[model samples]
Target: MTPITEVEGRRLPLSNLDKVLYPATGTTKGELLHYYAITAGVLLPHLHLRPVSFLRYPDGPDGQLFFTKNPPPGTPDWVMTAPVPRSDDPSARQVVIQDLPSLMWAANLVVEFHTPQWRSDAPAVADRLVFDLDPGSPATVVECCRVALRLRERLAEDGLVAYVKTSGAKGLHLLVPLVPTPSEEVSAYARRLAVEAEAELPSLVVHRMAKKLRPGKVFVDHSQNAAAKTTATPYTLRARRTPAVSTPVTWEEVEACTDPGQLVFLLEDVAPRVGMYGDLLAPLFDTRGAGSLP
Candidate 1:
């Protein structure tokens, strides 16, 4: 049964409040909505006006998952959506999340994570460049961090700042803010940078997406920077057994950190951490000072 709840003055009908999304941690759907509500201050800015595609897990993370780009039929008109071109049909519009109310509405729909595009329409520019450092079976988040630190140094040499975050799984993400570069240009730069990083650190990084080659190296995935590709929005709880989050961390922590588990922020840890870090990647969304690549 579903129950209608009030969120930010909007009515949200949430089903299975006690339904366990993360069985190991017993985290419920209600808890997920609450987390989004509490972290909206830091999260909404990243989601505002950006196209979003959802990975819905109707039966929780342990069950089957499906991806949806359009607002399901019967969606309320109050929910904001954008009409982005579909890959198969350029004219066909795909719905996107644009505000907090829409965000909460998605949570109720069993959207496990809020993943948004890298660009926003008003600014009409690539807001950030992302590096998805995925570690293979033998390689872990700890190893991913080592690779992240190295990439950070390289980005510094390139005259850009990189922010670190856990991938909510066994990996790390390195995001760099850009000043309105074309999505294609940003994607090209990311790809070249990843390839360069792989070439420079062949022993530590893998540039390809093949699963077999990733066994003992960090996969420096640069493809997420493309125009329509999405990355997990910060502060969203991951669909993991323990309900881990894609959390932002400091470079200091990245260098000294050995156990990746310690850095796995939870839904409960966000508010206080944001209090301390004040949205470490928030500047990535600001395009007012958008400058050309240095």
Candidate 2:
């Protein structure tokens, strides 16, 4: 095992290097070593023994994270993201995770929280429902963005404040945070939104449960919005060679991205650390008047 080094502000102890392995993917090559090295450095302080995980983004380096052996059951995926230059004109070097074991070790030390303010102990005040929309055709990423904005407006009108974040892949996720309610009600709310989507973009969107039924169109995935269900938290680090994270984006840039695969942010590019559950998703922590993290 190698000693951990400090970068930015975190100190990483690289004492473990026997448990991690990298899967081969064209997204990045032979760079898993570097990724693990960095992941261990970034996530070591937050690890735990439970099967914890979150999506990673590719911003500064290739996308990947040193975490979970495999994601927990019911985890949402393809939420991975990577940051890319408007142009790779200089053909910069791809970042890498050099030590797998340490990265994997560090991964275990961190506790991952998705489904914001999700708790089995404390009373949940919000039910997080997300509509992660992906295009069915090659028409354009903007076309999908147009639909996302329309969807966000529609959700907002219903009293559920909608926040938009990049899947860090190609799609945009419309998040609706509500007072913590049961799954059945959450599912129903999702169903209503799905219906609304179909009504608003009859030609572009479909709510059919059967994937085969909705050909060449965007489908509203109400399934993820179910009670106790979760969507990848925006800016989560995923365990892939090229670390990808979910990103919050301005609606204008949403339409400009071409490939759904290209719009993610890397761990290096994400804001450092989180304050409890993080403020972007602060409503989940509101507990209304419940007072501090319980």
Candidate 3:
């Protein structure tokens, strides 16, 4: 019989507690549940009302992985969901993790939580802008940091404040809060910034997605601003050889980082860091005070 637990008055059947989800670090299913439960306070704020796309790795990182925007077949009826319109197909009802029970319910099966810049209620408007800085081989995250610093200064000049976070992989993500704007307009503005970054730091940055040009440069991916695209939600665990988290960081930390290893944050490091610094990306929630595109 599967072990049953009660969370926020909801009955949940948690199984495979001993199954290893991260082979290299030996992280198990139960540990992942605990991580999400403890971080729910800080994590739920970022996910509230946003339509999430789950990236599941049921058998672990080394096994098959899949992405699903719609709720899985057996999803409990109590879990909140919202209808998200699509350009090509009929609207799909996507999962919305607005509270602890809903969050833990999804976390039990998902390794990565991805959400668009707009919330489910206002699907046509973008509430934030994202820049995914990916470094090519020989150029690691240290070089990406150098580029992020320059981009930060540029955004400041435009009256926008940018917050930094680790992609939980090899690069950095810079997000800027915005007063509600059309997604198309936001994407255009982001592309302009990417172009400016490339021109200003040609030797270190590349705006286009050409693999050949990325050998020793940092690719500034601004396409995630599209209404149909999604970015990994902050504090969400990434599927990798080990348990790493898409953790938020301060600009001071970005400025001080020189080694690639310095930015790598495992699941164990997140709760303590949040306890010390609070949510560094908390400013992203101030939609009313956010700046407009110049």
For lDDT, candidate 1 versus 2, the one ahead is: 1
Rank the candidate models, highest lDDT first: 3, 1, 2
Runs off by more than 4 Å, candidate 3: none
Encode model 2's per-residue lDDT on 89-156: one tens digit a residue.
Answer: 33321111223342443333332224422332222233456677766655344556777777777765
Ranking by TM-score: 3, 1, 2
Model 1 residue 51 CA deviation (Å) reads 0.8
RMSD of 3: 1.0
Question: Candidate 1, which ten residues in sequence have the lowest lDDT sum?
Answer: 115-124
Report, for every candidate in turn, its global Cα lDDT versus the true structure.
0.77, 0.48, 0.92
Name the lDDT of candidate 1. 0.77
Q: Between candidates 1 and 3, which one is better according to TM-score?
A: 3
Better of 1 and 2 by TM-score: 1
TM-score of each: 0.92, 0.57, 0.98
- lDDT of candidate 3 over 1-294, digit per residue (tens): 889889999998888989999989999999999999999989999999999999999888899999989889899999999998676657678999988988988887855999999998899699999999999988999999999999999999999999999998889999999999999999999999999999988999999999999999999999999999999999999998889999999888899998988999998999999999999988888766698998
Count of clashing residue pairs in every prediction: 0, 53, 0
In model 1, residue pairs whose N, Cα or C atoms come closer than 3 Å (at least 3 residues apart or on different chains), thus clashing, are: none
